[model samples]
Target: MVAVDDMNRRILNLLKADGKLTYREIAAKLRRSPSTVRDRIRRMEDYNVILGYAAIVDREITGMKADAIVLADVEDGVSVRDLRKLNGVDGVAEVSAVSGDRRVIIRLRAHDSETLDTIISNKLIPAGLKDVEVRIIMEEIMRFPGTS
Candidate 1:
């Protein structure tokens, strides 16, 4: 495990809230110098404690009006690539082979519910996915660290 010190944790927390915060701003909040903040962040990156950064956009504004988490009991013969390449799949945010009744879980985005339905019916069903459970995402409460 990466041994993150208290100061580094504070830096991470600040960055989690707002990745755009400059090193100077983070230093001011943490009562540290910009050089110190920069060095620590660089060190964290080197240690793989910090992976990368991204921007969080409003899906609706980006023409994605619907999001769903789909859990499927995929048979052993099913191809993940086929599942991933489905039409109208705006984004496959996550796909996991998990230990449960459901073998795969996928996070997807679409322009609307009708499109989502079409994708599920035409693509997912035909791809050999069964016992599918889809949950619509209404709100995002929190995001990953160092992301908007």
Candidate 2:
């Protein structure tokens, strides 16, 4: 595992809060040199600990009025990549292939529940997914790599 020190954790926390923060800005907040912060960030990236940045937008404000957690029972020949390309699939946040009743879990967004239903009943069924169970996401309580 990649060893992350307290400084590294602090840097990650800062980035998580606002990814657009410049290296100099982060350095100022952490009371460190810009080069030091840069080096640490580079090392984290090298270790694959620091993934790319994303803009966390409010779905309601973006017209994505609906979101769902879809548990798909994929057949033997089904591909996860194919599922990701389906229409109205704003994001394929998670796809886990495990030994269980459901093969994959996917998070997706659409303009409304009707659109989501159409995407599932029309698109997913024909794409070799044997069965699907969908649950609307009410709220996002927590996300990964949390600051605490």
RMSD of 1: 3.9
The residue-level lDDT of candidate 2 at 13 comes to 92
Error of 1 at 98 (Å): 4.0
> What is candidate 1's lDDT per residue for 15-110, written digit by digit as tens?
887888999999999999999999999999998998987687877788987888889987578765556555444455666667789877877778
RMSD of every candidate to native, in Å, equals 3.9, 3.8
Q: Write the per-residue lDDT of candidate 2 for residues 1-148, one digit (tens) a residue.
A: 5679999999999999888889999999999999999999999998899977777777778798778888878778777656655644444445555557877776767889898888777766677687788999987787664321
lDDT agreement of model 1 with the native: 0.81
lDDT of 2 at 75: 75
After TM-score superposition, what is the CA distance of residue 14 in candidate 1 from its true location, in Å?
Answer: 0.7
Clashes of 2: 0
Please give the range of 10 consecutive residues that has the lowest summed lDDT in model 2: 87-96
Q: What TM-score against the true fold does each predicted structure earn?
A: 0.74, 0.74
Evaluate all candidate structures by whole-model CA lDDT and list the values in order.
0.81, 0.78
Q: Which pairs of residues collide in model 2?
A: none
